[model samples]
Target: MTTILVTGGTGTLGRLVTERLRADGHEVRVLSRRAQPYAVDLREGGAGLDAALEGVETVVHCASTQRGGDEQAAQNLIAAARRTGVAHLVYISIVGVDRVPLPYYRSKFAVERLIEESGLGWTVLRATQFHDLLVTLFQGLGKAPVMPLPAGVSDQPVEVAEVADRLNELALAAPAGRVTDMAGPEVRSLDSLARAYLRTTGRRRPVLNVPLFGKTYGAFRAGGHLAPDQAVGKVTFEEHLAHRFGR
Candidate 1:
């Protein structure tokens, strides 16, 4: 059995990926700074990482910091993988990171470059924003009487479980550089999504479509984050909401 080490294994997507790999009968070890069984800090390069990657054939890198420092973490993972002679390093990245001007998106793009140049066999899968992320955003915004949404911004929110399944498949296959982008089945405006959330969760809030200015909004307005041509995920945001709320 191929021994695989999954970083951020306790996270949203990481947890699903770990479960999928284990269900497939692969020897899986989860890496987390706080969790047990495999406690290794990606930020601190030392014996912990070395021990984690000792017999690991593949490393599914799902760990990321939206607050920054993701590039450094990726570098640390790459160096450790090289030292351990890991056969494959699978990385999960956000869609349109190259085009999105947000700092978090830029950090993800930088990690993509690092993985590409790391010389280690690697496969990078860029997926659209997850449904859970959108729901959380709307839930936070829905607290107010009026929810503000960026105008002309559309999202193709894919399911995290689907992305996790794809990551599992990629981990088993030979490294293929960057695979096709993954997106949700349908694309909807941000305002519409927010309104849907409000209706589903019984929150009565007026969604205000505010015109957003800046490169980040420009990229989103231009549909840079969308992969209509590569809409491989079958789950729609509405279906996800329905399942979540039991509607």
Candidate 2:
């Protein structure tokens, strides 16, 4: 059995991947800011990182910062992996990072470049938006009687559970450089999805279509953020809603 070290093991995707790996009989070591199995803080470098990664052959690098100091943090993690002589490193990335001109996405792109040039065994999987995005969209829309859908925006969101399963499989396989993109089984328009979601949750709300401004919005509207052709996810939006609201 390979001893796998998982960074960000307590997070949404990380947690699931860790559980799956452990259940599959791989010896799992989780890196976290706090002590559980192993303690590591990629942001603030120290002996902790070195100790946690020592003797681990494969690493699942799920640690990410959506804001503040993400680049430096990712670099630190990479440096630690290099120093420890890790055999393989797998990074989770979003599909739209190259097309979208968002700050956070730019950081992810930068990290991918770093991993490529590091001369280490590496694999990157670019995943689409998660089913959890429905909750974020709902929160953004609030309780308005008529919610404005960003006109022309489309999505091929995946379930986090499916993403986790793929990550575990990657952890066990030989590094393939970069894997095929993963996305949900359905192609969905933002407006229709939102309306369906609200209805399923027993909410009565009308949707209004409106064009949105900015390059990020434009990129999304042009279907730059979706991966429709590579629909590998098993969960549907309705199933996701039912899981979330316990319907």
Candidate 3:
């Protein structure tokens, strides 16, 4: 049995991955800065890394700051993996990292590069935005009759569970360097999604399509945030919402 180490196991995706791996009967180790048997911050070298990765064959790295930080944190992981002679390293990244000018996206892009250049068996999965994110956005929309959204932008948001499943599969499979891009089955407008979600949850709100501005809006309007047509996932937004809300 391949013993795998999971960084950021406390996170939503990380926790899911850990649970799946454990259910599959694999030896799993979760690396968190706060836990008793955790590794320290990967930014600076520490003894905990050496201890955590001992006898681990594979690593699913979910440890990352959404906001960009010094690139050394990723570099440190690479260095630790190499030093420990670990076999495979897998990373989860965003779909539109290259197109999105956000700092977090830039940092993810850089981390992908570090993984690529590390010369270890590696697989990188770029996934679209999660459907849950829309729920978070709608929470702030208040009890208004109309939910406003950036008009003309498109998204192919996937269920976070689906993304986690793919990650688990890749973690067990041979490294493919980069896997097929993953995304939701449907392509829908931001306004339409918000509208549908409101109706789905019985929010009784109409969707107001507001005019978008600047490069971010333009990029999204051009479908830069979506995956290509060939890589549609099985889970749909309707099904995800239904499962989530117990509807």
Looking at model 2, residue 160 earns an lDDT score of 96
Candidate with the greatest lDDT versus the true structure: 1
Q: After superposition, how far is residue 8 of candidate 3 from its true place, in Å?
A: 1.6
lDDT of 3 by residue, 1-247 (tens): 8899998888778999999999999999998777667757777757788888878899998887865553677788788888898999999988888987667777888889989999899999998888887777886783666677788888888888888888899999998997878988888877777766776788877677899678777777888778867356777778878888888
Instruction: Please name the candidate that would achieve the greatest TM-score relative to the true structure.
Output: 1
Better of 1 and 3 by TM-score: 1
What residue pairs are clashing in model 3?
none
Better of 2 and 3 by TM-score: 2
> How does each model score on lDDT?
0.91, 0.86, 0.83
RMSD of each: 0.8, 1.6, 2.0
In model 3, where is the ten-residue run with the lowest total lDDT? Answer: 65-74
Q: What residue pairs are clashing in model 1? A: none
TM-score of 3: 0.91
Q: Estimate each model's TM-score.
A: 0.98, 0.94, 0.91
Give model 2's TM-score versus the native structure.
0.94
